[model samples]
Target chain A: MSEKLKRFASNNKQLLIMIGVIAVVFIILSLTVPSFATIRNLTNLLQMIAPIAVMACGATYVLVIGGMDISNPSVMAASAVFGVYCMTTLGVNLVLGTIIIILTGAFLGLINGFAIAKLKMVPMVVTLSMMTIGTGLATILSGTRGLPRLPDSFSEFFNKTAVIIILLAVMLIMDFILTRTKFGRKLYYIGNNARTTKVSGIDSESIIMLTYVISGVCAGIAGVINTASIGTARANMGPQSQILDIISAAVIGGVSTSGGSGRVRDAVLGAFLVCGLTNVMNLLNVSDYYTTLIKGGIIIGAMGIASFRQQQAAKKGV
Target chain B: MKRILAIVLALVMVFALVACGQQAAPAGGSNQSTSQQGSAGSPKQDIAEAAPAEKPAETELKHVKMGLAMQSLQAAAFHAWADYLAYRLDYEAEQRGYEVELVTLNADNDVTKQATDIRDLIAQGCEVIFCPCLDSQAILSSVKEVHDAGLIYVSYCREVSHDAQGDEVPDLTVNFASEEQAYAGMVDLFNIMKEDGVEPVKLIDCYGDKTDENAHNREHGLRRAMEEFGYADLPVVEVECGHWEPDVCGQNLAPVLAANPDANCMYSSSDFLNSGIQKAMEDAGMWHKHGEEGHVYFSASDMYPLGIQHLREGYMDTAVDQGCYNFAVHAAAGAFDLLEGKEVEPVQLVLGTQATYKDIEEILATIPLWGNDYADY
Candidate 1:
């Protein structure tokens, strides 16, 4: 048992250290902020983090496959709006509306995927431009208005518990694809070394684009849940700032932003850790500016820890 | 693996297409209570047209906590709302001899997050929730959700009210932050200009985001006043759109100042853009106190802390106080009334004060400015 524990610790040093840091933050917040540790606060915190975590789950694929997507914010809004617009204006039933929303995300993701994979555009620039375009498209679709008066959800995706369930499902499925599928292995290979992946006879481009489509599908699911829970579709949804939260969660949860290894579970943990701070600050009556500053500090601290661990490993010739 | 992926993709799209066909067929309906958007983003329906929503059936307060959710605290006025709401709730608790804790959250302009924030408030055991509805149409379902949960939901300045559609959703809305607030300021500022020997004021309408409803409302108010004051035919100078944030507002206004060197009487959408306006004015050697040479008459809406200071020190001409503090105070009182199961007005009105340097002190005497009252906070 000790030997197995030692081997796991040795292999996942960064994750172990991250868990420690997260635990410390949890303990400190629980000690200082009144009711921070209460079941109600934690449950509410779960509700708050669900959509963000789900978004992060999709983002894990992008990051693991050596990509970055800033466009998720606008993509989220545009897709959600189109879906709801179809439901309310186009007279699509709730099921069709929900599917349309996912398809919209998939379509946008396809554009992103095609650009980065086929045209070989820079991931950040392509996604950033896509973000602005998505925002504009959302405004146009909703006529720069909120799309509310939504019909009853066709799926079991509404309510607080349902949102959390959706998050869990997304996390498991994304994790399974990454850890247990031939598709995920190809993604890791492309992320680790494109040249090597090509030399190894892997159809990296197709896999890369497919991964983006999957990311889009995840985003669509998130949109459906948001529209259901929010009961309104606006051009500006939660993804505006949540994109950053998603990225931070991925990085903090030990998903390498520089490409290579990542886990959906780790991304979920990252979302919890990042969002928990906001929850704690609100409860304590602390300002959001402070929360932003602290989050930045934590990210930097996370990077510093990763760098330090690498240095220690190199010194020991591990 | 590719075959599996292809099959899954094919099946999903096929299902979506079939679902599209299913929309026309009468489907199994669930008894839903949530609402949707009315206009673009702002509530387009007239307040008078909105029939009072029937209160959520048999809903009862579960907890003793009160909540105030703001659209965003990036604007100073919302911060004031949070502070004043807390203070007002505390004051109410003292008067009522029962403590009701406060839970405040900011959606940061994200409507979906606002939903989650409302849910959190519900989970935090808040009995009543107050918000300056970010999207009037977007918040209808949330209003229903709150009422269904046996809690009270109160909103201010709704543009897309479900009540107008005759929904059974009984969400009380406060009538604050309206065009009337801006029109009142324009009228008052002109009178002040007459009294201070700055009469015959030629107005330069400094625009905000052209797409924003607030900008249009304030500009319309200014235009209405200009027409009333006999300056309706002024050629509209197009200013750079700032999107209502300080950094962007200031950056955009710089070029406008450079172009109109002798432009006088700059009226903006909101004094929340005062920082940007002040920065540009000071840079162009145009910023001066009242009676100072190169002093451009500055009138705007939502007299935030800086706007109040600008008015107090005679740097600004007029500030259309949107009654943020007043609205919050009333909302807090309304929440208390709802908590005690007392009958309350569905549409409560809190008239805003059009404060100028001359009348600000007098107005301050009667009205509580949250910025001034909770400045230390």
Candidate 2:
């Protein structure tokens, strides 16, 4: 057991700590709220988290590689609006519209990747600028008023359990790409030390670009799900939603801003952590203003704990 | 030289005739200037109607321009309101021959941008400014500046206050009557439901942002209905979901449903929020029970075609139709009256209608009243 502990501490301490915290929180919350344990409630919870979870996984990759992707939500908004426009105004098939939206997201992601990797712009500034551009374009494409009149069948996708399953599948695939494949290995290497990775014949630029593309695709999917979930595609829907919550989720879920050290699974868990906390807070009838303050405090607490753990790891040279 | 002398002599004669006429007139005897006396038989009224009268040759009349700023055109209902207001002002100004020109500004919901936009508008010498403010009141220091400039200023949707001499009146009143619109709608909604013989209705009341007077009024209106409709003893499950966002409404409804699973009726502040509740109920497969009892239903304050459509489709019960376009028209009319020296009531106007699914289809046919033209943009 000692040997296993040492091995786990060496490779998976953050993951283990994340799981433990989630379990403790879940157990405590379930004990307190009986409805928290129900399958219907849990399923509903999973559906709530899946879209953002998938997006967070992509954001995890961006953070792991020393970049930020604030552009995701705006890109998501633009794609969702386009998809709705196609589905309604242009009279296209839902599947085709979905594809177009996904492609639009991927295309913007490509732009973000190229600018950050090739142009060597600061990730924060670049993504923030893209956020503005993407949002403006979304409003223009959506005709200032939002793309409404979406078909009932189009929204059915979000209400069913299939959405959660799909997000999970995507997460698994992303996990495979980040761990099993040669490209995945190169991503970790590039994230850890770009100069070293380059000297070792890895094209770090390509990997970074690809990561942004993944982020974009994730954002597109998130947008579509969001549209389906809300039954409307307003460009500035939840204007502060991305910055106020997504960053906290990523940082608290163990995705390091220092880069080169996190898992997609960790990010997914973090997304669920936020959703679960929000659910519990609502059940407790916490005011939205206080809910925000509490959420901010929780993220700060998580970050503090993670930093403390890192200090200990460094002291032990683990 | 001779022709120039004759022209000068004719001008002097005309000036002498005007001076003698002015000297002969009693104080306050006539309101019309000599330049306005071109015709005697109502032809002056015809001239005012047919032609853009040349400005009195004096260049000293200070041009008092006012800026109209908006948050966004994202909601179709809000768009209709904005367009109607703009159209009324422009059309009336053209008819009335006023020197007033409206500068339209769209902020797209950015609070920071709205502040800067107001500042820019102020810098352009806007004497009177009207804003449908987006949250964040401190951002409206520019409004105070405009007021300090002695410009007539009012917020269209939200009221602003001034430091008065121990008397508190609305500093800058909004156009819509927040209390009446909300109270009338909810009262009508409950009256319709009660008329349908839905006795002892258990209400799950939900509303929008508490910060908004419109939303606050909607909440109190529901409270009033419960009190007035003899359902004062009926149980109520209350929640505030902030925006008219459908998902927020749905999420808010989830817990309310859990807390009061047997609630016979649900009341919402906005049609959009009501739609969210409907969506949540439908998803839970408990929607049928709402109709089966002829008691379980959703009611809201602001009405839209979608709400009416949902009602007809057996998804909603009743909604209070606050004709937003009417509100816009009345606001524009007031602005015109202020510009043209026509007497208008200083009090806010409350415009509304009450309709069931059976009657709303007729409302939808008059597209110009509620349709999108995108002209304001």
Best by TM-score: 1
The sequence of per-residue lDDT tens digits that candidate 2 reaches over residues B30-65 is 222212223321113333654555543334443436
Give the candidate number with the greatest lDDT.
Answer: 1
Candidate 2 structure quality by residue, lDDT tens digits, A35-60: 56666557656766776687888888
List ranges where model 1 is wrong by over 4 Å. A1-47, A89-93, A140-144, A154-157, A160-162, A280-290, A293-318, B1-63, B156-171, B175-177, B189-243, B246-267, B277-298, B308-316, B357-377
Among all windows of 10 consecutive residues in model 1 chain A, the one with the lowest summed lDDT is: A148-157
lDDT for A155 in candidate 1 is 28
Q: Compared with the true structure, what per-residue lDDT tens digits does model 1 show for residues A1-318?
A: 999999998776555655655666566556655566777677778877887788788888999988988787678788888998888888888877888989999999999999999999999999889888988888777763345567545323576677777788889888998988988888888888988999999998888888777777777877877777667577777446678788888876767776777788878987887777567555654444454665566556554554454455458975
Q: Write the per-residue lDDT of candidate 1 for residues B111-157, one digit (tens) a residue.
A: 77777677667666678888766666667666766776788888754
Q: In candidate 1, which residue pairs clash?
A: A145-B40, A148-B36, A148-B37, A149-B35, A149-B36, B34-B141, B35-B141, B43-B159, B43-B160
